[model samples]
Target: MSAGSVPWTDLDSLDIASLARRDGEKWAVAPSGVLPAWVADMDFPISPTIRQAVIRRLDTDLGYPAWFDESHGGPLGEVFARRMLNRYGFVAEPTHVRLFTDINQAMQVILHLGTEPGDGVAFHTPACPPFEDTIGKLGRIPRAVPIRLRDGEWQIDTDRLEDEIRGRQGPPCRALFLVNPHNPTGRVFRRAELLEVAKLAVEYDLMVISDEVHSDLAYPGYEHIPFASLSDEIAERTITLTSGSKAFNLAGARCAIAHIGVKTVRDAVDDHRGVLFGQVSALGVDALKAAWTSSDVWLEHVMAVLSRNRTAVAEQLPPEIGYVPPEATYLAWLDCRGLGLREEEPSDFFLREAKVLLNPGPLFGTEGTGFARLNFATPPRVLDELLRRIRGSLGC
Candidate 1:
């Protein structure tokens, strides 16, 4: 089915009151009557295909998943490999794909298997907090390579990144955590930029753990390049992590796939699965299969709504708020530094005054201070109300 066949307009008009009653963190964490624009999950419903698949599984087979079996070349791995090849032209060997409960678990397992505890891991600053948190929790040094907003574009400070790796004191930098269509900032990195990153990884002999959950959400004009797909040498050094959860609004399913190009690295992760990493749920396996095979239409429609919402933010927000419409994801990284509000963090002010729950910039990293991340994957009417509340609070 094509995106044109879906009732995108009706689906986009989600009922806020009903959403608030749901058990998800995005809605449940916010106070009563406050609009939640904090968590990464979307307010939209799961794809019909995914919903049907779950129901079908519950009705017939609630048994253990045969994900590890080699019959028909492994179900989950085959689906992932086919999707990668058909969608992105990236050739993923089915044997190299591994399943996990979620991306966070995948990261933890990858770190445990690939590098020593004291090794340093580098990633862009103002990043998804989990990347830094995971590194620190694993006894690894978290080296933040900052990205600067220059001329209204978020550009990676490549020279600074190289210097950070080279100037490491105690532990050697062993891996780089890359977020394509970067979170919070939402910069869909260009091909040239990805090539540079690949080159840097090769030069430093660093393993690249690329989180590409937002790859499917790139805007009409932007393209998402898989880091491992750049070249054969880079592929050998890259572990690409992705999931259906982000684009398909299936976070609750808790399913993620990791494409491990290196044989030894794959073996290391697989060996530690039962003890350190938990198994993927049977329902998660079904949802993933349905998502990769039949949910593109639903995803396309969601992207359209998100694109409209992004434009609304840019056109409607007051001059005091700095917003560059993101190239991917429903997240809008607002530069609240110019607001000059009495409060140090704009998110607090928004929550109290505007009655909107936004993610505090400081949570992402020091570089994220004086900013806020807003989830715009809401209905247009609700988003309009949110903007109105903010405008009223600003007295603009």
Candidate 2:
């Protein structure tokens, strides 16, 4: 779709009352009249194509799904392979692509198949909670590599990362959990940065689980370099997990795809699909297919709205709050240390006084203690009210 044809208007214009009635976690988890800017799910409507596809499926009688067969890759796998090639120029064979209910499940499966208990999985600090949580639940150690904010830009401290890999306390570092267009920070990993990570993964003999779910949401002037797409060597050790869920507002749809470059890993995951990993819903599969194959126009429109909202958050937020406009995703990681709250977490303060809910920084990691994550994927009017609430609470 051309930029001009893309609908630049705010589509997520639900008022507080309308939002409360919806069943999304963003709304359901919040009390009545309180704005929910906490979760990563967008407040926007589902893409027309995806919605229609789901509706068509609902008309038919539900039955057992044709499970993803390893011999002949299913339609979802083929579509995902085509999407990777067309969007990111990544060459993925359909046979190597496996379907999952979501990225979280995919990660769990990878951890189970790739590493033994007590193994160390290294990921960047201030990461999305799920990454660390998954590691802990699987009886593994979480090795947090801190990302430093250097000269107003968030950067991976490669030296520190290498040191962490080399000087492990317990179990060997088995995997590197890489988030491209990283959550919270929204720093799109540059080609050079990705190559460095690839080098480290190869050197350390670490399995790379690259989460590129937000790769499609990157803003203009920044590009998301798929970690596995760097080289043949990197691909051999990588399992790239991605989905249209984040970009297309399909979280409830419960569908994700993992492009496995290693044959052994692929086989292990496939073998356990029904026994260890549950089957994906037929509706989710249909929605995913529609999203990847025919919803580019809708995605472009949503991106336009998100791009504008990103700017709005920067321009409208109080000067005391520090925000680096994200290069990808709808989340704006706000540094509230300068707000003079002293001991009070910014998220708690906002929720109590401003009646707006945000993800507290500390929840991401210790590095985010004075920070708060704001979901900017809402209507302009709602965003205005959100800013007003924050400003009023701060007495600005």
Model 2 alpha-carbon miss at residue 182, Å: 0.2
Worst ten in a row by lDDT for model 1: 1-10
For each candidate, what is the lDDT?
Answer: 0.85, 0.85
Off by over 4 Å in 2: 1-13
Residue-level lDDT tens digits of model 2 in 27-113:
888987799999998766677788789889888847877563644556576898788889889888787788788999999999999
In order of listing, the candidates' clash counts read 0, 0
Candidates in order, TM-scores: namely: 0.95, 0.95
Poorly placed runs, candidate 1 (over 4 Å): 1-9, 70-73, 168-170
RMSD of 1: 3.0
lDDT of 2: 0.85
Per-candidate Cα RMSD to the true structure, in Å, reads: 3.0, 3.4
Against the hidden true structure, what lDDT does model 1 obtain? Answer: 0.85
